[model samples]
Target: MFIPVEAPTAFQSFTLVMPAVAVGNVGQLAVDLIVSALNMQRVGYIHTDCLIPMIGSNPYATSAETAGELHTAAEVYMAAEMKLAVLQIRSPIIQSKSRKFRNLLVSWIKASEFSRTVVLSSSHGYQRDDQQLKGIPLRYLVTPALQVSGDTFKELGWIEMERTPPLPGLTDPSTEPRLSIPGGGITKGLFLDSCDAGLSLAVVLVFCSEGDNVPDAFTLVNSLNSWLHLVDNKGSQIWKIPTSWGLLFGSGIPPAIF
Candidate 1:
């Protein structure tokens, strides 16, 4: 149930930033970073039964007068001139409808004809195979359809994600072996779906332990920026935190008790 305030015609030929609901909510938080960093405009929302019910004050609203305006579960933002679109999902995908949601998303993506899609996600730190323990905290997955983008990363010598160990008897057709992502929710499914459907897709994610992951979110966004070139590097900061984040922990506690 994707609805468009700007109309579907506008999304044709654009690149997309999408995220899955994964461990530490890293993907969703990275979406927030992208939305804040680009100052993108809200183009629409997805009205679907596939996600948990959620409603809150607009996280991207900048002014006091509109800061508390109500918003929905999934929002669409766009940097139209840049041919960039971001799908920021704020709630968990309902277990039963997850497959349907993925299918519908892929269908919309194909219909819209986006040139590429980058998924920002994360996995449980403990789930990492020994190889993931070293190097940068992040890893990337590139499907054949994403060879061009993958090439750019390869040029940078970025580490490709390690394939999940195959279960003793499980068989996937590939002779090279299939990859698995244990802690990522829709990440593996969506990426595979997009690839099989011939939609160019890539996944950029990290392994992180659970807890306050705001820092992880920033790091992940910066990593994605390295390739997407979404932020200007001239500045000391890659991106600024959204004004809403100032309220994330709420006003400070009174010191009188201390």
Candidate 2:
């Protein structure tokens, strides 16, 4: 579930939220990806409409009644006609605002059979109400370690290996080097890719706001300038609109025209 954290430009920045549910292989995979990418330890767990060991259901159990209910609820929250949907999933185990969902999720992970997961989020436009505190964006929740490990297993053909390999012999084993006891170095590449994805998401937001018009380029340039201006002023900012002083002074133009 690679949910790109982006908002098209037609609207002002607003909060985007989603209910975590158990849909199927795809749903679980997405949930795992986000959790791993953000290194999220203990996010809260919803009583996901689907059954799982975490919910006290038989680990091997299958129930259509439960799965359908969860799907219906998700549909209600994501109606196609609405520009945005706010759906709520039922979770009997959790019922508190102060309770950090992330913490709870960590405990669940420790107890679960699932070995790996990933989560990705962005902190764009996020803020904290308390003067001394700061808001952390969605990106803060990803689990980098797992993502890196998964990539390592994929590239080295180790995920299905029978056992660990022995140290290489002094005499070269065939023309190539034996599998190094330590895995190959792909860490830096993985981290750079992840951060690149985040920045790309931010840029997409800006592009989406501008539409398909020749003048949209100028509009985008101005919007970026405005954003920079706001940063320079420490939040003090104003929109830059096209205006002609002569049109007002030369014609003795009406106030409405001006």
- Best model per TM-score: 1
**Which segments of candidate 2 are over 4 A away from where they belong?**
1-45, 48-100, 125-258
Q: After superposition, how far is residue 65 of candidate 1 from its true place, in Å?
A: 2.3
Instruction: Give the C-alpha lDDT of model 2.
Output: 0.25
State residue 96's C-alpha deviation in candidate 2, in Å. 5.7
Q: In candidate 1, what are the lDDT values of residues 58-157, reduced to their tens digit?
A: 8987898878778889988999888999999988999899899999899988888888889989888986666677888888887787657336876765
Give candidate 1 misplaced runs (Cα > 4 Å): 6-9, 167-177, 250-258
How large is the C-alpha RMSD of every model relative to the true structure?
Answer: 3.0, 22.3
Estimated TM-score for each candidate: 0.89, 0.22
lDDT of 2 at 159: 22
Candidates in order have lDDT scores of 0.84, 0.25
